[model samples]
Target: MTSSTPLPPEGHGLPQEIIDTIIDTVSDSTTLKACTLVRHDWLPRARQNLFCELSFPPATLRGEERWRSDYEEVLRSVVMDVAHSNIKPPLSAAVRRLKLHFTDTSSELGFLEITSQLPFKNLHAIELLDSDLYRFEDHDQDALFLFLRENPSLKELRLDGVNSEPKKFLHFFSRLAGLQLQLRSLYLNDFFGYHDDYHEPESTFLHSLPLLSNPPALQTLALHDVSRTEADIFVIPLLTTPSRFFDLSCLQSLEFKFPFIESDEAILKMCGATVMRFTIKGIAHRIHDGVILEKCFHHLSNLVRLELHSVHPDRHGIVLLLLEHVPILRRLGQLSMQFVKAPSRVRDSSPPYTSAEWALFGEGVDSKVDQLMQTSNPSLKHITLDIPCSWKNVTEERIREYFPKTNSKAVLEVFRIQDS
Candidate 1:
């Protein structure tokens, strides 16, 4: 009688799941290949786990053939290997997230084509980072658009460190809207690198986007280093009202970085929104004085949270703005500040105690926080100040001298009520 012998477990008698897990986290390709050879049963699992996110090393293909043949072969192999695998579905279907990370080397069209083949219908999120695809022709941009359009499950899209023409940027927005898909979050940072042809202002682009009949279901929008030099004045009025386009509603959260917030006019226009959360970043140099801030924040009566980022001590104007405008400050739930460098030579400046500068710049940073409580921000519970400072910087020490250790009786009472 021939007895049936059971096959031994794969990978040192461990099960496939454990082997898969190990393969999933392994970063070294040589080590992974060695592990795969441990058994035939382990091969499929190991390959799936390992090559699901394949990154080509330029060192593997060097010389004249690098351009004409090797790049294409490597890319085509990676895509076909992942897409045609019988062990599972397309890599995109299984991939919840994908990141196209490029090191300090030039990548060819082969890489772009591989990305284009990636099944986008199942990708929940994707980030395109630090790529040197400088000045792709319209055809390349259209291919990317085709991918985005087909990505029904994609909810978040982030494009960072991409250098392209302004027309390409506009094309991206147009394609996204044309697809009429649902995307909850979108972040574009340095999408258009310093293009000299962008001689106009930032507002110009802002005003035009909303007019699109089919904007995505964008709940959160963030733009950084997007020069507002051309931001049209009409955009201010356009964003002030709540509007809906396709799946995208009025933005629930908005963040503006750098030069966009440099003008109180822009700030005032944005404050008109009934948005639940608002984050502003800029220098205190342009907020003018307390009076202007008051006017600017007047429309933010419904603001549930306010985050401020400024670099100057003159932000005492900001304190007054908060105190006067956020009277329902008790209703405010969150406050944050991203502070820049502190001023030098305390003694060389105004009286630390009497100055509004002290309130904004000096010791009792906490007590000044108390004044914000007079408003209805009763729900206020979280406060965060991401203060990046140097250890040897005396400015931090000088500024800490006035931080109020205690809140006002009214604020304490509100805390009590909320806690109860």
Candidate 2:
């Protein structure tokens, strides 16, 4: 008898759902491109992942002239593809997020105009980075406004390193308020208001917007690296008066980097009832304030996830004091403590802690963990320690030695990070 060779299995033998699940796990663009050529049935999902996010000029590009030229070319190619692609829904329809870097230069205004005209039906998030909106001409500002207005599906907006005059910024929000888009998340980092009137209170800028009285309900809000004036003027007012821009009662996540103050305490009192996730970033020494521990956690009964990010070496016993306030959170499940090294110019130049000092500190942390385990029941499922790269080994060893119970239970996780 002659032996016959068996043929390779067909790709169609696997269910489409399984194929999609496998493709979803692939993140490399090169691999995704290769997957598209393997079977026609895989093309839609592959293209969706490939075009889900569109960034102008590419993040790796440097130099203004080079990036600007690349931006124009990419924009042109995208527009042409959208208009002429043979695919049913078109490649642009798969885009869900856009990241655009803008400048005050006149040439950039032209780019903005062209961007405003692109058709992105499913776009939901927009990030304006390193932009100086204060210098935009009337037409340029109108173009941006039109772009935002056209995207009714937009639900997340992030402004990073963006500057605008107080009046102009307020006007922008006022127009956005008119759109009545249901924004679910907003992040403002290194945002500034530029004007000669430094004496004016910050609240006036936000309070003046009549249309913002009933703004969209946001689920997540983040304010980072904001100046003191901006915090006092914008952040405090927004947090304290949730009805103006957000419904704090429905807010699920809040992240901010601010020195604890009476206003911040008041914010906790308001939103603490429902917020399930909370993150606070500050200098290590200032994070464990008396009032915060005494007054804040009591109101956060619903908190499920808590992240304390310290921008300096936490040698001042923040762990014990902060953890002392955790027992009140009956629903707490995840806790993340991060120690970030500050910049060299501002960092303390003290010598590394001696082994004796590490042992003492570890004991305190261990005792706190013991109390949490005894009192928190099974709700405390995971604990994470994010230490700076330089101290990762020492910290992990000490933590594992001191927190033997937690380590053995596999509830402890330690990570080495370059920066926070």
Per-residue lDDT of model 1, residues 1-36, tens digit only: 432443354324655455567777873378888866
**Model 1 spans with C-alpha error above 4 angstroms:** 1-81, 84-91, 101-111, 130-134, 191-214, 230-249, 258-272, 281-296, 309-331, 338-364, 375-420
- Predicted candidate 2 versus true structure: per-residue lDDT over 120-212, tens digit per residue: 767899988888766766787677778877778899989898787766665665566557457888888887877666556766766676645
Highest TM-score: give the candidate number: 2
What are the Cα lDDT values of the candidates? 0.53, 0.70
TM-score for each model: 0.58, 0.79
TM-score (C-alpha) between model 2 and the true structure: 0.79
Q: Poorest 10 consecutive residues of model 1 by lDDT? A: 411-420
Model 1 gets an lDDT of: 0.53
